[model samples]
Target: MMRTSLDQGTSDVSDQQGGVRTRTRAAIDAPHLRTDRWWLAPAATAAGLLAFIVYSTWRAFANADYYAAPYVSPFYSPCLAENCDAMRAGPNWDLFGGWWGISPAIIILIFPLGFRLTCYYYRKAYYRGFWASPPACAVAEPHKKYTGETRFPLVLQNIHRYFFYAAIVVAGILTYDTVLAFRDEHYEWGHMGLGTLVFLVNIVLIWAYTISCHSCRHIVGGKLKHFSRHPVRYRMWQWVGKLNARHMLLAWASLVSVALADFYVYLVASGAFDDPRLF
Candidate 1:
């Protein structure tokens, strides 16, 4: 996919204030230095992202303590593997073989992982935070060569639209998992607890993040020529646009909420704590 600079227009502007003329240029000269707290933001972002990756990877590989009665880790939901905990098993496909009980999360997280990895906001965040592709505003990047997302593995990012579609299906499945949380071990309805609340919040945040995706917005409205003719589409697009404005917030919030949801289930299943019941 071709990339265009969002900060393209109005690169140079002149302002007169306090009887002084000052001019600002958008593009900075290479190898420049400005003494400021430039590295802090990117460093913090990298730390947060790296921590999440490490934690999620550990949980994904973990085969135990992902389920309790009426509560399942979000990471291990839609459990396709046999030998999963009896309470957490979801449509077990008898996947893998004896001597190997793989976690379903290992297989299922790829789609949502790809969706987040290739997100527009995340691209900018990581490109600056991890890769240091100009680490921060007015800072020179570490790489001597810059090919951008045009070559080889970077080109794979073009498939993000497809990943967006996959994310929608995953969101649906997770939503269903939340609905299932309403039942107890005996399949009796109206069961409620801390885990149920966690799952409910997790699904809502995931839906918010997924539905507010730029790709979703584009798919819903990109080809339309007239907002006048397609009032319904236009209204939906408008709402999506409003959501898209806060996509980055939803993205991070959903990530944290989902991880918290999984960790909550893990703790309960592991007997670290008892899941308090409300009804």
Candidate 2:
């Protein structure tokens, strides 16, 4: 038998029992042995997520400049209150009467926000970025052990499937809003503007991100003994699987798209500039 021991900067291998058995030495004491810059990724993720949270929170509470003619901010889409008339994208939903005085965006942002917050990729991103739980591969976490999602706060992640349902509805509403964006300020058909293009691209990315979700993929085709028996679902599952491969990309792209789309609406609604008609 061969026994191996590793010290601060040395390694010793000795024959113990004159057998073929070998014991491998490990650097268990060091936090991490990585020589490269492993902190950069987590730092960048924290910065990006923090920046987006601050910007979105400010915009959500602004309660103004969220609507510009047919263009509506994604954060404030499906505006469902009487106060939405001033910033109405489509016909006022009037779901909540005059009683709800707060920003209408506050009422509807929870679903989409919940979906993103509970996302698997986002869990990994924030866990590594903010919590520093084994920040990178081969790095040891500061905590002694993990309870995982079995706890109170972490257990909420299980509701991601429900959030996926709400996200689908939100995506549908945004699709309707995008369709409305085809009209001009006068609400006439056959019109296109720079904002129209922006909305179009943003909605496309949103749908791509939403549809590529893990829940959506599972719902499309998860538990089945045979794929051949259900051809349609199998085909859909194949498509979703391919999209799922790019879920992270779609997630970030949609995040930026929604923010930029809202900013464009803000610029136009604030009267900073007119939406240049492409027609």
In terms of TM-score, the best-performing candidate is: 2
Error of 1 at 170 (Å): 0.8
Best by lDDT: 2
Which residue segments of model 2 deviate by more than 4 Å?
1-27, 87-91
lDDT of 1 by residue, 4-69 (tens): 654423223443221111243443223445678989989988998998999999999988888777
Cα distance off (Å), candidate 2, residue 52: 0.5
- Runs of candidate 1 exceeding 4 Å displacement: 1-30, 88-101
Q: Whole-model Cα lDDT per candidate?
A: 0.81, 0.86
lDDT of 2 at 150: 96
